[model samples]
Target: MGNFTKWLGAGLGFTLGGPIGAIIGYAIGSVIDSGVSVQEYKSEQDDYKRKTKKRPKVKSSTSGDFEISLLVLASIVIKSDGNIDQRELDFVRSHFIELYGKERANRAFKLFNGVIKNEVSTRQVCIQIREHMSHSSRLQLIHFLFGIAKADEVVTASEEEVIRKIAGYLYINDRDYGSIKAMFYNEADAAYKILEIEKDASIDEIKKAYRRMAKKFHPDRLQDIGEEHLNAAKEKFQSIQNAYEKLKEERNF
Candidate 1:
């Protein structure tokens, strides 16, 4: 009876102790699992950083930068006309802010201020644009710059000269340059020339002359010409239109 009691006690102890041991083992396994998961999370974070650490920088400079630079230069010229008016600065500032956002706009303003203060050379920058950009790009750039300069709704001859010089740097042909100038700067005179009429010509005379010249230079008639020459002719016709518009504006017709 004593032996049997001892055997039963040993069997009970083995069964209950085995379950307690299994619980302890499970707790330890859970702790190890959590530790591994934490290390993996950290390792993933490090890998992400490493992958992005050596990425290349983006270059978003389109023709916009050239436009921005010339606009700044124009601002300097216009401001040099006298005191840099708030209107002019705001016009330029708004343009920069619009193009490059607030951060780059601030930088552009600072750079322009430095130019005005004689801390940097705009001539060199202009040279870079001249060397790198195409003739059409320079024309478009100067046109926009002129727009900004005249945003005060008035353009000085000095400002005009600045644009002309910039165009020269960009290697724009003398003829094309003259054509653009005549279009914007002297549109009325150009129209009078095209129509072979006086500035104060009668309205009937202006109308008659416009009809004759329009018929002669119409783009459809010049279809035989190559695209390049056709483009030139088209520009001429546009100039005529611009001139006529200017004359009408002046006459309030």
Candidate 2:
């Protein structure tokens, strides 16, 4: 609970207030004082931000808020088909443990339970996260959600539509969205899509794209966040490696 309060919805009071705060507040009520009001704190922040020209990148930060946002948005996809699959639960649990230790993960687990039961504005949530999370972090967030969707080995149309709309709201361009989608989706030119290069792209073009993508998803950028996030970034880094390797083998470049 102490760990979560550091960043959960750290700056979301501007637009959202009720259910989200309730879910988080519900999880850490013991740790957080009942008297402290998010609305009151947010009111001050709102007024201060209005007078400032350079606002802090609260949304772009990969702190407590970013992690919480990931799980909340994930809940939307998990409940999209009106059925909860064991595979999805297992996938989320494993990632949760991997990201946060057992103590914190267990405490935060309750938030997810509440999220699935309540109705959330997925579009608004996406907008909030997009405004705060870095470009690479946003890519990884969607990539993990897709993994959840396909955990049962079949991504339903509803799941696809929900994930697609989330990506759009995050301000992710079509090429970037297609690249992430290609990684999970079964497409003939998935390697090209993952590399964000065209099928007929020259070897030099492919090589350049691979390097660019690799730099963008590098794990070092997440080292300041936490070891758990660094591990996740490593996994994404490997994916980019595999995609490039596949192309290199196929093209003999």
Candidate 3:
């Protein structure tokens, strides 16, 4: 298991760079096969599956599997505050059904229930997700997780904390997470509001507000505040970019 983890960590670093890395890792692992026929390997795998209490097949990508698992963990954290509400469940269900088939979506819910009952460490689960998924896909998966967390029209500090911690584990930097958070908070709406315009705001209004925020939060300008605040300023600048895009799309401006 230690060796496997080491290899998995290297594989994750490789995978973060590009698709070619993932392909190469798969090829290398396939070539280094431990002298077992495909049929024999399947038989042994099945035996291991039958013997182990954990879901054996989950480690493989059965399409949207990693994403579903993330949502499951996020739901567990969100519901830790109280009972899982119907609104929260419905939000999760809609996202899953869109990503995976209904059957798999239900399985995801059940699997999440089982995992939470066992008190699985979300960090470890996120590591598995990183192992099986590409960097971009993981970002999108985290976005969906945050979306569901905010879907009840509110985000508790606990839920936000869960999302932020998972984002860090997933290699989503503070900058990117801020963009995602802005998207959730309808900062696009704020952008339009800043411009005294709507989704149909003119290109001139868009440019004007962008220029104003850019100057206010630019890293160079924020340097006087210190490095920590400078870094935060960078993240805020990115949120401005996201907000502009959202409003631009909404207005086709």
Best by TM-score: 2
- Model 2 lDDT vs. the true structure? 0.70
Model 1: which residue pairs collide? none
Full candidate order by lDDT, most accurate first:
2, 3, 1
Model 1 per-residue lDDT tens digits across residues 63-158: 333434454456546654566667777877786676556865664464355334432244555565555444544554554566556767677777
Between candidates 1 and 3, name the one with more favorable lDDT.
3
Off by over 4 Å in 1: 1-64, 98-107, 119-123, 182-187, 190-253
Query: How do the residues 1-253 of candidate 2 rate in per-residue lDDT, one tens digit apiece?
Result: 2334333444333223333444444334322335556654454344433422233333235455556776787888999998999899878877887788776676556457656666678876777666656777777788888988998899999999998898898887888888777878767799899888999999999999999988877888665355677777787778779899999999997
Candidate 1 Cα lDDT to native: 0.51
* lDDT by residue (tens digit), candidate 3, 1-253: 1132222232222222233223222222232234546554344334433333332333334233443445446655566556566777777766556545576566445434433344445666566666665554565555566666776788788888888888887777775566456556655356555333455657887888777755644557533223432333455457667667766676676
- Model 3 stretches with alpha carbons more than 4 Å out: 1-64, 188-242, 245-253
lDDT of each: 0.51, 0.70, 0.52
